[model samples]
Target: MGIKKQLGPIEIIVNNASVFDKLGLEEVSAQELDRHFAINVKAPFLLAKSMNEQLTTGSAGKIINLNDWRKARPTRLAYGVTKSALTGLTRTLALSLAPNIQVNEIAFGAYCHPQIYPWVDHVRISA
Candidate 1:
């Protein structure tokens, strides 16, 4: 069965996929940066674009992008840059898709598995 037949309609999209590869300034390669952009930024943009019709068909729609609170991370240069770009994309999409779809970003702080992300010390959500 097609997605429409199974799910009815897509009302909410949560973009949570991200890459946090550790790379220093000198270690960051062109391919690495492109990979980060392709997954972290382009994927979400394309998904939203492709689902625009379905999203706007409903009375209300929401697109939420998961982002990191830290603006800069020297340990993961390319990852940080792509995340920053995602923030801009969220803000721009919100204005562009107004009255139909609501685009927002949830910034997380130091939240990751200890083994996967040894750099992250703790996870805290604050108002």
Candidate 2:
């Protein structure tokens, strides 16, 4: 039997995967923009749609989107634009999926990237 048969329908979805290309406007390419959006925006949308259907009735569900508040930052164009699109999607989903599913977004600040601080020890990266 499928998971639905064994357990039940999915109740929560957390969109956490994101592409953060450190390329600015002049250096950012079309493919980069597309790739960023494909992962950052499209994936969440598809997942949300699926979850919305699976949770159309019965108990309540929740969709939490992990967002970066640096969407307006000038250093990252594609990431910012896609994040903005996600914000719009989140608002629309919140409005449309109300009563049945709760769609929410949690904007986060910058943290240490492994590439940027390779020696900082991934566990204790507060430095």
Report the C-alpha lDDT of model 1 over 44-123, residue by residue, as the tens digit: 99877866766535477789999999858798999989999999999998998887888999998754545536555565
Winning model by TM-score: 1
Residue pairs with colliding backbones in model 2 are none
**Cα TM-score per model:** 0.82, 0.80
Clashes of each: 0, 0
Q: Pick out the ten consecutive residues of candidate 2 with the lowest summed lDDT.
A: 118-127
lDDT of 2 by residue, 1-127 (tens): 9987797888899999998877889988899999999999999999988887776457888999999876875778899999999999999999998979899999996566665364344445453
Tell me the lDDT of model 1 at 57. Answer: 51
Question: Which consecutive 10 residues in model 1 have the weakest lDDT in total?
Answer: 111-120
- Give the deviation of candidate 2 from the true structure as CA RMSD: 4.8
Superposed on all Cα atoms, the candidates' RMSDs to the truth, in angstroms, are: 4.6, 4.8
